[model samples]
Target: MSFSGWGYVWTAVMPLAVLLYYFFRKKYKDQHVASTMFWQELMKEIKASPYLKKLQHHILLYLQLAALLICVFALLGPHLTSEALEGNEFIFVVDTSATMLAGEPAAFELQQELMKEMATQTGGKPVTIVTTGANPEIVLRKEPNREALETAIDRLAVTYENAKIEQTILFAETLIDDESTVIHVFTDALDRSILANKAGMAYEIHGIDQPLQNVSMRQFGLAKTEDGIRAIVQLVNETAEPVSGKVILTDGEVEKTANIQLEAEEELLVPFEQLPDSPVWQAVLQVKDDYTADNSMAAFVQEASTRVAVDSSLHELVGAGFRSLNVEVDLMDPMQLRKAGGSPLVTNQTDLLAGQMPILLIGRNDEKTHRVAGAIETVPHALFTYAPFDGIYISEIYPPFEEYETIATIDGEPLIQLSPEGDIAVLTDIQLTDWPLHPSFPLFLWSAIGELSGTDNFFGFFQPNEQRAVALASTRGEWEIYKDGEFFYSYIEGQGAFSAPQEPGIYEVVGEGKTLKMIVQLSNEEKTLVQGTSYRIGQAEETAETAELSIVPWLLFAVVFLLLVEWEVYRRGNAHR
Candidate 1:
């Protein structure tokens, strides 16, 4: 209990003085009466009331006095505090996660105890309630009203997601201005990664003392099949100690359980056999550990299909790669020709899509039908030329060309240049015909592959990035995709196929079937973890408080209102008599 308006204490004396004056005030009497006996009766009644009936007879008097007392108290606005209520600023963060629900007295119970501590230490200091979970929420902020602050604390609940402590800290940073603020955080220690980035503001950490030993179904995957279902389950040992657990797979009445052993920080994979054909299945990883939410994963499985196309010339290699990668690739011809039915390139048109144009033309003079041969000209897509291609041995040529510069003189010539008009021609002054048999055969292969394939200049085994779809089939009816243990996406029966249009990730198509796993190797930045190992707090501020009712004032008002009603009743009774 605390007072807000202590300066009004002297005004309280006025009400007391008024009460004293009323007590000693002189009264007038009427002489005429049916009998002095009746008057005597009244006097006797007053005396009896002084003994036992006094309170009952003069309830109105008590009411009037109460109203006056309440008004004085309200004007004084006095506040009382125990030794516990002496903090400058009360800052409390409550951990609201499923893990909090597991401990002895329960996480919420522990939070209540802490809340009491905060309430006691509040005195007249403003209190703030910060809720921690997947998304941090500010339940209260700098509210000097104690009852309202306590109600907000009581309303806090736990969530299935983990706490984002760093975000809460950042939020606190913005809430507080002076360093004198006392901040208290209450939570079960989750992944320290959440705290990797923080504003340097220091605060006290009150860990809800509990050791979490959990074995969760970290991942589950399924692939669609026409006749039966196939699935894969991964169990992770989230505990510090090595633990063994049983994994059960069931579709309603049917069930299968497998025993598994996992070292600390390691995981175990349990594959499911042909399961009964069903649209949905539930898998439970039963852990001997303390917590259970992290123990099981439920997924709905469904059937789907897809198609993947691959170029013909890369069949043997692509086939092997697909088998290793577990993706089906259909062989097809290259789409680089002028038309689907057109013959391959001729000598002057070595670039597959170059048409009849030369790559490069170098002369002070200009020629008709040729685009330009200078740096100023924008060359055609397939035509890249250079001046002086007279001596070079080009072996194993995919498209024969009439003009090519010798490899030995490339330093002095344009080498392989693009003409201003978009023609691909090499300088012809150097001499060396058997360049393919030279030590640069591999380098030549790289260059030839780049020219033949209409892909970007990156000459690797994998096709240059062109958006294309790939289909995967499974004996099971559903599947999940994961990259490095983190969930990406999933597919179920009737959903068709799970298509990835992005760069690359080492994907695990976990679920039913013999083909239980596949890896997608992406060399692009879109799929890479560019920021996982690093974090920075860009902005952190204490959250602003929403408009809320202050219970202290309301409670005081209720007491005042009741007193006033009693006072009105007393005055009316005195007048009627």
Candidate 2:
């Protein structure tokens, strides 16, 4: 048995003080007239003896000593020892990341079975279960029934999102109420150092020791060519052994196949030519690998619409920017464009245009100018990623537009703005500002074309469990999301953003008379099949035939009872005297 309050054991010597008082205690009494001579004789006899007297068999003395002994025992904080598990509460932390889905029987399945076995051995101890993912979740909480634990274990599933095991473990640690609780972690990528830093937390880490082999599609895209669309596929072998596979490319109707071999941990880029026109293309790798989640990938092929129409006075400058990026430019007069109604138009006029397509407004044609001097502030947007407004001077600026999102501001005045309809308006003229002389001018124009053409925001690739704002033409109706041609969920209007599925695949978001396709893939860290470090931490030094149970409360109760009995014995003895 262990004592939590061993320092208090020194209080056991307190009973020695009571014993000394009893041994040297003196008695006094008043007597009648004849007692002086007899008292003198008795005092002389007492003076001849030692100052310390022997202990007598008095009930009060025995009772006081017994009470002190019980108090000393209580102070020592005794505990009972039994042969069983130490803790009364068990907490299980399980990882649900994509890597757990590898191996023949799968690491997640093995973790489930192991957890259930340990839970059964707990002998009806309260158990809490937590899962790790992009967001950690507590699936079960403080359940004592064995049947409930098995049910919760059987319902456990794995996700394709990246693992946040350390965060989840810390989250679980907050729920512990005492030191008797034991935490059990089951994961494939948990670092041992994460648990070591916990100091005094009792936990055991269970890791999967099985071998894993996987080949993933790192990148897949399509580009329009002179003859037809071209498919680009990049594959990486995550295992240590060489692998051979057949890459199959399909456009829903036509199929193209290519055979390739890759060395250990090698990456290969394969290209497919002369593919028929299709809205979506899919690539599948037919190989024997443990993980199948990353074997196939789908992408929406961009339409042949890399053409921009310019009707601004600076048409030559805008045309030069588009042509530099291999994009065709069509120059048109402002009067002609007003009458022709062409889409994706670029003009400098402030008046409303005829077409409903996206437009890039350079600036107003007014002759007025305003001098600006201060640090420029830019909003966090995709346009500012490559084209920053640093080292540029603006001598003229226009009034800020209230209906547009201000991208850049100087002294709280809007300089660059974007409308909800995907149109961009540069409030200052290039000739009036020295920005055109800077390198950011061409990059700004390139990004502006992509924004107006719906190439950067409408549809693209995303990572698993990623949340992105929905850039739709209209946000007034319910949106439907589908995965692999099956309806998955419905999104309400004005929600503004949507989280991608935890699994990797192609998803389509349909709403407001628009259909947008997005491809979700696993992260680079999740793609590699490296085994994580694992070991137990803060485990108690327990014997095979002993489990400790605190008995301090019972000892305290005995001390209280003994003090009451001693008080009663002293009161009764004094009443008789």
Candidate 3:
């Protein structure tokens, strides 16, 4: 037994004071009796039952003492030690992924309630909370305050990204030490085998395993048409029953609706033709479903307005690539330009127009030829999105330039390089490389034109919580980002990167006098709400102080009962007298 507040032990003096008062209280004075015969009879009766008279005289004193003692015990805050409270350190791993929002009340909402209940019962034990999303975050660490724990649990929210549950669990395990810790995982889809394999860990999985029905837009794209543009949308029914709904495509001004029906687990492609040109278009799925994160998607379209002046020997190929993207191309002869003293925007003749315009230099200074030796390494950049350097044979290349950033390299030789001024320099001679024969050649030229002309006609699409470095045409000042027409975040010029919002919507980046639209959508994994399994691992070792059962209420109840008995005895004694 333990007492929380020992200061209340001084209250034990109350019972002693009551005993002293009973022994030294003022004595009653003898009064002259008018009826001597009745007095004499009462005295004879008292002598006949002396033991009963003594018991009646001391009963009130005993009752008063008992009540005082019990009150003191109650104030001391006594508690019984139990084995159930051994592992007082608790770790809560919460999954904040989008799938937790699939159910009616939402698995996340239920998890919050459960956490609050368990936390309240911890009796001021230390608790840690970890939330999982695109990245795992420790929100609360070893906090013993009940109010702080409740506040942290209430503040938890669901992210639209997929949860990294396995990683988060491993991270939580790192916090365990010599102390016995109990870990509770709250998630929507955790595999039972994961916990079962954790042999010596004391943990429990609280998972929500309900059948979820959902319909999602698998993909959305736009294609250039003779009149305007066409919208291609693919929809999927993720349920076991047939589903039908209307798909509404809108550009904030014009709205087009299409009704469609699908069998269970079916995918259908629906195209809308002759739609007027718009900067952005959105598609909304109007199906009754558990998961709504994937029901809506947005697409951004930008018309090509970049004009390229090509003077390279491969102008025919380059011009063909530019024209295909609806970009105007002006082809110029190298000899005619040299004779007329005309500067070329793009050329293999580096001496003709050096440092004059944003140029795409093909084989500028090839003084020496080096054969490819080992594996080729390419840096991640916007230029290599569709144009990878795989299977491209390079026999000769110019020496690496210190002023340019190398994009692709063979062994130690630079193959593709880009300057800070947006000039793309291909060190390898195109005649000696077979990259031009590949289908990615035109795509490479398209990227090059966009980079040189400082025009970004490409649309940016990303999954929720995804972050990437953004390359804008003007990299000069702070860029402001807006989501759904509201300001979201901002970043500086050189450090131009931003993370997608937790919700699915369209984001606009405004900077350097230009605006670009980016779309954040739900990934396929988030859309498919898989049922999870729950498991309990090893048990917590029993300890003497594992739990505490407070006896204050019981003690106080005894005090109340004793006081009532003392009051009744005093009232009866007075009435008899």
Candidate 4:
């Protein structure tokens, strides 16, 4: 509503003069019509007065007058004043982190609306856009054209990655020059980023201070049950009061629901019984909160069979323990296991290595006969998971005879050793320690089987940002990790490892006539929704909200379009005459 050239208002009077001339100008008289028959020929012979035409209810005069007024208005340009034109150069750090996806429009979604409003108010000013995804990116940098800017903004998407706002700010700092350039961040909070000691731009955090009520699905999995599979899910309520909701389990074909009630800040484990048969499973909470990204999750399940050959001599103890568990075990001839291929060999002697697949040599001698007095020192290994044997006694032990890796030791002697392929040999009978009777006995055996049997598919899931060794289903062929059915990375079957994707979702890998499904999910760290106070980096200054937006050019275009219409109307009217 403001004008840049108000002092030139006196010039608009020039168009009014033309309007006055059209209304009061003298008119031309018609020649005396001697005969009515000759009047038609006389109209074609005599030219109409160009300067003094009859103006009684004439359309041309009105059209001319309107065109003159438009010229006057175009001279006085007009445009709406908006708050976005505050800076000559702007750098926007928009947080697209998982926490922003909490409300009806999502904090990030509202942030996008705010950004669009700023763009509309840009008045053609340059803007640089930054997104805080897993990897900070400069979506649009110093863009001045409004159409192109809008296109870039439209392409922006919500990311399930953790907040990389600090990194994004670092990237944005490079775009800023002086104290006048403003950096506005739109996110759930300002302090959620690692901004305590980082040095950079003098930015203000424009975030939603209201804490969104969120119930998060921290983790979930499926365990074998007597009747069927049981779905185990860990949930937490981030609100100030107790929340009541249901957890739905689905396999794309069938569905089941389990209701949950949790107090504020309370963590609970809920299990759903009797799962249906499905390769793919999804767990979704029924809680309706501001944040819903963590409300639902997907997982894939794969099962494997384990076969072990236990010598007839130790069959009374070791063989009985294996049968007591659900896994398969054989007490027959060792040759049958060797020819069967891929099955592990469990014997009291190391010479059983003739088979070459994978071996677990359990010492045959009883520990009670040759008791060793020294306490053993064991290193951390997957076999020790849930199995604590720190003070267990070992009497007779066959120290590692080869250069294979030693897994554990007693005083200065090696107690157990293993090869890269999980060919392990316990120098003493496992029954010698309290581990067999311990609850971790089954877990220990399962761990050994998973490694030695080369289980094709992973049994569980991983957090998006977590890194661990991923075992391939087979060692004979190369394996490739894929995202959305396209190749992303490749891994050697022998090495059997690749970094997990940093975005929360499901992924798959294929090789050796088998496919493996894996789930990479967001960590617990991203579920926090508290906002942070605004701070600065280099120097602080006030923000601007107005810029020069003139509509004179657009107005002139309208004037030209109107004039074209006037010309067309006059031409058609004269032709009819």
Residue 376's lDDT in candidate 3:
68
Looking at model 4, the pairs that clash are 86-544, 102-290, 102-291, 190-532, 456-473
Worst 10 residues of 4 by lDDT: 364-373
Instruction: Report the C-alpha lDDT of model 2 over 421-443, residue by residue, as the tens digit.
Output: 76888887777677767777777
Report lDDT (Cα) of residue 16, candidate 4: 75
Model 3: runs farther than 4 Å from truth? 1-13, 19-71, 79-88, 193-197, 302-360, 365-459, 473-476, 494-497, 541-546, 549-577
lDDT ranking from best candidate downward: 3, 2, 4, 1
**lDDT scores in order:** 0.49, 0.75, 0.76, 0.69
Best by TM-score: 3
| Tens-digit lDDT string for candidate 1 (278-378) | 54456776667655544554444521211233334331533343334343444445453233222112122234423542112212111112111212222
Which model, 1 or 3, shows the larger lDDT?
3
Residue 111 lDDT, candidate 4, scale 0-100: 76
lDDT of 1 at 334: 47
- List candidate 4 stretches off by more than 4 Å: 5-55, 76-86, 192-201, 222-231, 250-257, 272-281, 298-454, 459-507, 510-513, 531-545
Candidate 2 clash pair list: none
Q: Estimate each model's TM-score.
A: 0.46, 0.58, 0.64, 0.62
